[model samples]
Every structure is written in C-alpha cells, then in structure tokens.
Target: MYKVTVYVTYKDSVLDPQGEAVKGAVHRMGYDSVENIRIGKYFEIQVSKDEDDIEQVIEEICDKLLANVVMETYRYDIQEVEI
Candidate 1:
C-alpha cells in the first residue's frame, strides 16, 4: 500500500481571500508580527502501485485536472505503508 500526501496552494500572483481574512483576524487579535497568509488545500490518497509510478501518475493528475497551474501549485509525496 502507498500513502500520498497532496498539497495545493495558490500561485504567487493569485489572490487568497481566505488567507487575507485570517491575517486580518490575527492582526485584530494582537499579532502584529504576522506578515502575510495564504490558504491551501491538503489531500491524502491511498494507492496500490509502485512508488515512482504512483508519484508520476499523481503529478500528472495534479497538472492536468486537479490544479490550475496558472493560479495554483500542487506537490505530492508518496510513502509505503505496511498493512
């Protein structure tokens, strides 16, 4: 078995409204040291395949379907899991 961790985040030029809201809240709560914040998504997938192959497939999926490369970036890592 393999476990995959996928992280999806906005591109540098993309606007992150949720992250901005969080930053505002943080500032209101007295954290003046906060500079900037960005919101992102996380996904965990279970796959039955060789690590290298699975990683390639997942990367393709991210590039083709799961993420918008112009506005967002995605990265994934795979780990073997004992059942």
Candidate 2:
C-alpha cells in the first residue's frame, strides 16, 4: 500500500486572487501581522498498487491532471505502508 500526499499551488509568478482576498479578509478580522497568503490544495491518496509502481502512477496523475503546469506547480511524497 502507498500513502500519497499531493500539494497543488499557483506558481510564484501567478497572481492568486482568491488567496489575496482571503488574506485581506483575515487582516480585517484583526490579524494585521499576516503579510502574504497563497492558497493551495492538499490531497491524500491511498493506493493498493505495487511498491515499485506507486511513485510513477502518482507522478503521472499529478502532472497530467491534478496540476496545471502553465500556471500552477505541485509536489508529492509517497510512502509505503502496510494496510
């Protein structure tokens, strides 16, 4: 078994309007120390594939669909676990 952790976020060069709006709201709510905010997506996948193939499958899924390479970037970590 495998535990895959994926994080998808906008590239540093891209402007994240949603994150900015949230940051503004947070500041208004009395947390003025908040400087910057970049929102992201987190995914935890449980796969019952062979150990050797888990990494490849996760990478393919992230590159081809989960992340938009043009404007967003993603990183993942794969761990082997016995279920």
Candidate 3:
C-alpha cells in the first residue's frame, strides 16, 4: 500500500483574504508579532499496491482536481505502507 499526503495552497501572487482576516483578528487579540498567514488544503490518499505509476497518478489527480493551475499550486509526499 501507499500513503500520499497532498498540500494545496494559493500561488504566492494570489491574495489570501481569509488568512489576512485571521491575522487581523490575531492582532486584535494582542498577538502583535504575527507577520503573515496563508490558508491551504490538505488531503490524504491511499493507493493499493497493485497500482502502477504512482507519480503519474498523483500528478494527474493534483493537476486536474486538487489544485487550480491558474491560481494555486500543490505538492505531495508518498510513502510505502503495509496496509
């Protein structure tokens, strides 16, 4: 079996309004040292051992579904597992 961890986030050029709002709230709560924040998505996927070309599969999934190519980017980690 294989375990995959995918992280999706906005491109650096994109503005994160939600993150900014949270940062503003934090500042109101007296956390003045907070500089910047960004929001992102995380996904965990399990693939069977019988699957072939795990990298290709992950790339296709990320490119087609998990991330917005125009505004967001993604990265993943894959690990072998007994399950």
lDDT of each model, Cα atoms only?
0.88, 0.90, 0.95
- Winner by TM-score between candidate 3 and candidate 2: 3
Tens-digit lDDT track of model 2 for 1-83: 77889999999999999999999999999999999999999999999865567778888898898999899999999887887
Clashing pairs in 1: none
What TM-score, computed on C-alpha atoms, does each candidate reach? 0.89, 0.90, 0.96
lDDT of model number 2: 0.90
lDDT of 1 by residue, 1-83 (tens): 99889999999888999999999999999998999999998989898865558867888878897788889998888888998
Best by TM-score: 3
Instruction: Assess the local accuracy of residue 22 in candidate 1 as a C-alpha lDDT between 0 and 100.
Output: 99
Off by over 4 Å in 3: none
List pairs with backbone clashes in candidate 3. none
| Residue pairs in collision within model 2 | none
The model with the greater TM-score, 1 or 2, is 2
Candidates 1 and 3: which is better by lDDT?
3
Steric clashes per prediction: 0, 0, 0
Every candidate's CA RMSD: 1.6, 1.3, 0.7
Of the pair 1 and 3, which is ahead by TM-score?
3
Worst 10 residues of 2 by lDDT: 49-58
